[model samples]
Target: MSFADHTIRVRVPGTSANCGPGFDAIGLACTVYNDLELTLKKEAGVKITISGEGAANIPCDGRNIVWRSVQYLLRKAGLLDQYPGAVIHMENNVPLSRGLGSSATAIVAGLKAANVLIGNRFNRRELLQFATDIEGHPDNVAPAIFGGFTVSTVTRGDVECFSFLPKFRMKLIVAVPDFPLSTRKARAVLPAQVPMADAVNNISRASMLVAALCKGNEKFLRNVFDDALHQPYRAKLIPGMYDVFAAARKAGALGANLSGAGPCLIAYALERRHCEEAVGEAMKAAFRQHDVEAKILIMDLDTRGAHIVK
Candidate 1:
């Protein structure tokens, strides 16, 4: 088929990073996504079009994450000169800097689109590594690449990923406030040094959480989501953080924590009905208590990773 006859579209899942004590090592892909359409043109230049959230703020030129990802893959495969220029149209649904992995989704979508446009030259692992390099971390990129709930660790300059299909039915309730907190700013609030006791505490909790997930033991998870490394320090940045967690627990959620950075809290529930009601009530009470408008969503785990639609 001619390049003009093929249209590549990729949908990438948004991720919630640092689940409880996993801290930069675990992530789950949610139902939210960003869609990208790539059409090869007979012309000689690259063109980019964007719509939806962050359209006006995101870069539209070669500096865009999507553009950079595509360019990186094409160059790595040594087909940069042979491939025809293309037009990339992005439809973004995930909000930026709200603790959602919106940037990672855009990068993964672009890489998937480029790979399809070039006839699947790179495997999923290779594509993930490339995207992770661009993202500077693998928590979000791992789940966005492998889908479902993923436990990842970066060791010796490489990312190790393990995927788990949740045995128990679980729903994620996310509450995003109107105010945005940049991930960089949130990181700044964290302390550089931590006590040994705190370190051991998080290690045990992280291990327990992972074991509970593997065994599908909800009881073990009831108190296993505690974190001593990041959440305690970052909680200062989010107003009424304790109240949000308290509200979620009171509403029958298993556990709740700051989604990725701050301002967006995520709660885990076993039943859809309970989750829905809990999310609604938690959002209302959280907003009332914190004096900030918030939006709440009930999202499921995304099983399929980034892929081309056509």
Candidate 2:
């Protein structure tokens, strides 16, 4: 069997999941991106090159997450034997284990490349489900694939999701600490169950958070972020978590929360204030007061999601 050469490029955005009380259900896509270029050949081997964040820690061979995802999609589509060779070039700007959906980007990128090479056998919705299957959660994967703000749930092995553009103008100030906290460790610290009261609290708050965003009500947005579930337990591992959240709020942020798991806090600041840098510095100083150093990034909502380019 002979197949003509093909090249597919993909750009997937980084995501912040568990926004406030949404808890594995809601997510936001930011400007950070991980780019991949794949070229299919008639040969039967794979070559990958990765640079930028996670360059040292991420594998460049068969064990790489991107390659593994590519293989999974290709074999599932029954096209692996036909297109057995590929050259992959990746630029990973999202940091791993920092709660920035770096893994989500990789999975989405790989599946997209494989689907493109096979003549778009799977649509975006199917690809979103595939990415969510690989990630074990839809919050991050949904937004990484769909962009903007996404709320998703897993029901009977199916990923159901909806996404929308922000009704309000805002900027995100993400403060990343010097240390890394794996999602496994963060989840391990959480309890297997919560009280009924806590569950009810999160349910209401999560609903309001969505309404707040849709209605552009800053008051509800600010008040709706309180959670009684994961944040308190994970706080033990994240340095200056509460203090940093407070600092950002005092400096003109609408509200703040742990980006996804821990070690990075994303604050929603008003774009009109022009005080993002000051808020960032306050967050850094708060972490510094606790003997931890952190860096900051300012980004806007990425509404276009992931796409393929020539």
Candidate 3:
């Protein structure tokens, strides 16, 4: 579980947190990924290289989330004081600040790198807790660490989560608009309080959504994603958000949802995979009506979260 040499590469999957009604609780990991490679240096200095997504905007220094996460894990493990310098290289595919859990990938990658470098003193459970602590929530981090489907929460200042291998094999179609929606800005639009009716509605739908996914019941799934919680308030930020959902459904999607404080919309399919193209086109057309271009990605669930490549 440990490497004597300070060179290792790790891959972490991209994550989409909150599948409609399960806000800050459910996270789904996709096949898209971010890879991080670290080589220990003899001298006390670090070097970094970045490609893809926010490569131009992201920092290549200690300020980078990946780098900061590396240091954070090392410190927590009591290895920082004696740490050697390391060069970190990131090959990123997940879009930053687009609600695809880019930051969660970076955090998981860093922790995995450090664990392997130090002989993996921590187990996956420990690593997941550490990652959740770093990310300040388990939604994205939990799935990024455990992959597949995850349900997570913080209980009494501690992280509690579990992963599930879904009974249904679902195809995910993610359509991202040209514009970005920061989680901060999206949260700002929501009212501080909601009516008891709205709260009850989300709870009912969330329960049904979980049941549908577990039983592979597409009939129940079709109507289960109607969330009355976060989406309605945040839809104002993304032009045509609801329209895109409508379009995807019209194109044969079993259910459609805003992917985590999105400008990204994700849909599940139960019918012909050929309908993926139709759904993608429909979503894109909806975005174009608002003058925003978009990208539609077709992916399956990632069964594995983060792992090292020898």
Candidate 4:
């Protein structure tokens, strides 16, 4: 096997899941991304190259998630024995274990690369199913594959995704703290059973959040963003969670919530200037109050989903 074989490159966007009340169901794609370049050869071997964030931590062998995703698809397509050799070059911009869907992006990129390498045997939906199967959830994977604001639900071993292009002007400000919280650890803190009141509260808020977004009712968001299901328990993990939320609100954000598990807060607003200023100031204040450093980023909703970048 040599490097000069059929090659394909894929760029997949990072995603923020949950989006306040829409726990484990809704997600939005952001501008952050991970790039994967895969080459296939006739021989039977696998090599992986990694760079950027988590390059030192992520495995550069068959154990990598990207490599596993490609192998999964190839095996499913009954072409596992056809190509014995592969070299995967991964450039990751999304942070790992930070709830930015870094793993999901890598999985999506690998599936896309495998599809191209195998002569496009599967379409986007099929690839999405493969990714979802590996990720065990469709929230992040759905938006990473379909883009924009995606509403996804998995039922009866099937994943359904619906996307809506945001008509109103908005900015997404993400505040990432210096500390990191593992999703597994965060999940462990949640109780196995919740009170009926908690369930009903989340349901109402989730519905209002969706309605506000679809109808572009910014005012509805102020109260609609409230979540009693996960945020209350998870907030204990992030020291600055409440302060960040308050800062975002005071700084002109329509609503703010924990991005994914914890440690990262997302503020939404219609004005770019307000979003930038408010997000920045809020992040700084929150970090200072918590005695932790932070980074603030402003990005718009990514309408274009996964596609070849040539």
Best by TM-score: 2
Q: After superposition, how far is residue 23 of candidate 4 from its true place, in Å?
A: 0.7
Q: On residues 234-257, what C-alpha lDDT tens digit does candidate 3 reach at each position?
A: 888888888899999999998899
Which 10 residues in a row give candidate 3 its minimum summed lDDT? 1-10
lDDT of 1 by residue, 79-181 (tens): 6665647788999888888998988898888788888887888988787788878898888988888899888777777777898877787888888888889
For candidate 1, report its TM-score. Answer: 0.94
Arrange candidates by lDDT, highest first: which order?
Answer: 2, 3, 4, 1
- Candidate 1 local Cα displacement, residue 86, angstroms: 2.4
Off by over 4 Å in 2: 1-4
Q: What TM-score should be assigned to candidate 4?
A: 0.95
Candidate of highest lDDT: 2
| lDDT of every model, 2 decimals | 0.83, 0.88, 0.85, 0.83
lDDT of 4 by residue, 1-310 (tens): 2223878888888889988888888899998888899987678788888899889999887688988888898888887777666899988888888888888898899888888877788988888789899999898899999999888888897988888866577888888888778889988989888899988988898888778788887678888777888899998888878888888878888878888886688888886445567567776787688887878878788888787888
How much lDDT does candidate 3 score?
Answer: 0.85
How many angstroms is residue 223 displaced in model 1 relative to the true structure, after the best TM-score fit?
1.3
TM-score of every candidate: 0.94, 0.97, 0.95, 0.95
TM-score quality measure for candidate 2: 0.97
Q: Candidate 1: lDDT of 281?
A: 75
Clashing pairs in 1: none
